[model samples]
Target: MAKRWTAQDVLDLARLYQPAGVLTAAAVLDVFSPLLAKPMTAEELAGRLSADPRATAILLDALTALKFLSKQDEEYSVPEDVAGLLAEQSADNVLPMVRHLANCLRRWAELPKVIQTGKCAETGLGFRGTDADRADFIGGMNTISRPVATGVIDKIRPLKFRHVVDVGGGAGTWTIALLRAVPRARATLFDLPAVIPIAGQQFAEAGLTDRVNLVGGDYYTDALPEGADLAWLGAICHQNSRRQNRDLFTRVHTALTDDGVIVIRDVIMDSSRTSPEAGALFAVNMLVATEAGGTYTFDEYREDLREAGFDEVILVHQDEFMNSLIRARKT
Candidate 1:
């Protein structure tokens, strides 16, 4: 049923960026980190962050109003619940993803321009700059994927392999999940050179460092590490065009052992490309972020996989977003 919209509803929708901008700006400024230790006056926080005092006070008050922080007297502190997810000292912090969203918000603001030009939005390195932005992006992948990976891997139960290749395995989240799922199996995690160290740190932290070999190279230009019977491409397909995915599948096909299998984890759109609302929205994110990258339909994936010498393509699982699974076997 289509409900009628009112002037206030439209105004509310237009002003939705207010809270998002406040929270993202706070994340970029590390607002919650110091507050985790102790309550502080806005001026103190401003001094610590080298920010403007009045602005800091306004942001802190806004956060308090949002219940993300607690205010007592003239000081502010992060609530324990909020701190657990935003404080730098917390083990379960998701600041990386928050920072990445800040980056995305910047690009999304240029959506109208992208629509007009058929080009990606021009964005500067966010507050912490390029290296930090890249690290946060990779870390954000772990932040988002770590919780769901084990569950996603569960769908491919009875999956036994001596070795699995995790292509573009950002920060080793899926590799860790896969290795844990198959205790007797090992893995070769392949990603860009800058990302290998991050994945290495994660592998070491997971105590699976010795079980996974980290290979650093561009999948587009370099040879994939071979000798694996199974390949896992988690959350990677959406960053590529169909042509690029076919090329990537061809590489995976060559790198696999005979009769090997490949599994892809990404958003699989419906035939109309608009049913899974999240996938459609993500397509717009890709439109602003990549030259030629967006969600794909199952038929599109099947056709691409077949072109890469794979057969018996199947959608093992269907998810409204990135948890969908597609499996294919090398012929």
Candidate 2:
């Protein structure tokens, strides 16, 4: 049977519509930033931010609906539970993520070739040319992966691994999270040359420069650097066809030591394909937004890993949502 999202899940998603939820919290800590300690009229707040009041109000309502706030009259305030995240703003603020989704990466039309041939370039979902897009992608990736990276770090702690390679890592969120969890660990991030500079800046801002090594290379054409006890592919597999997916595994097999491990985190559907409504909808969104990106079932993911050289692929639930971890060991 398929897994169905509860009413709470829907409520949780509705909360993401807030324009200034994270933005408001981020600004709170800056000497020049506005504070959200109390409920303020959306019109007055929007005027100060030079944003549209109507749109801001809609976002506020969405945030309130998600239980992030308690709204009385026309004013809103963050809940005690989430106050810590919103109470302060700094370089570590997650506001970049909220703004990136609202302003940039607004779910553009899918690439034609992905529909026709099912393959995206190193740059998935476009956003490569314009400066605005570039900024959104970099910031969005860092924010989105922050929580996910934290989750992976905790899961892999039991296993004794020294080094990790994050293939197609966007801004090294995984690297930072992993290194944070494992103080003794070091990491390498592999990505396109263009994206590497921005990632390096993130690493510097995070004060993790000494712990990570950034490598610029293509996963399809170039050889994946090896010798790390573990490597990871985060949210990257969905952007390829069957042939291309296998090719990536073959590369990882070659790059790893005899008993190295590769961990994959993505929206893996249940066997019935009817469960996990979120994953199914996500797959459709992938169709609408990209040429080749998708969400695959665990069975589908395992078949690929098995074909590549792995002895076993174990799945771990990261959250109550469709997101899960696939741990494969090269034996």
Which residue pairs collide in model 2, if any?
2-275, 3-275, 114-291
lDDT of 2 by residue, 185-238 (tens): 888899988789888997998899998899999997999988888888877887
Give me the displacement of residue 26 in model 1, in angstroms.
0.5
Q: Across residues 1-331, which tens digit of lDDT does each residue of candidate 1 receive?
A: 7879999999999998889999999999999999999899999999999999999999999999999999999999888899999999999999999999999999999999999999999996788999999999998999998898899999988788999999999899999999999999999999999999999999999999889999999987888999999999998889888888999999999999999999999999999999699999999999999999999999999999999999989999999888999999999
Local distance difference test scores for all models:
0.94, 0.69
* Per-model root-mean-square deviation over C-alphas: 1.0, 6.6
Best by lDDT: 1
Off by over 4 Å in 1: none
Q: List the residue pairs that clash in candidate 1.
A: none
Which number leads on TM-score? 1
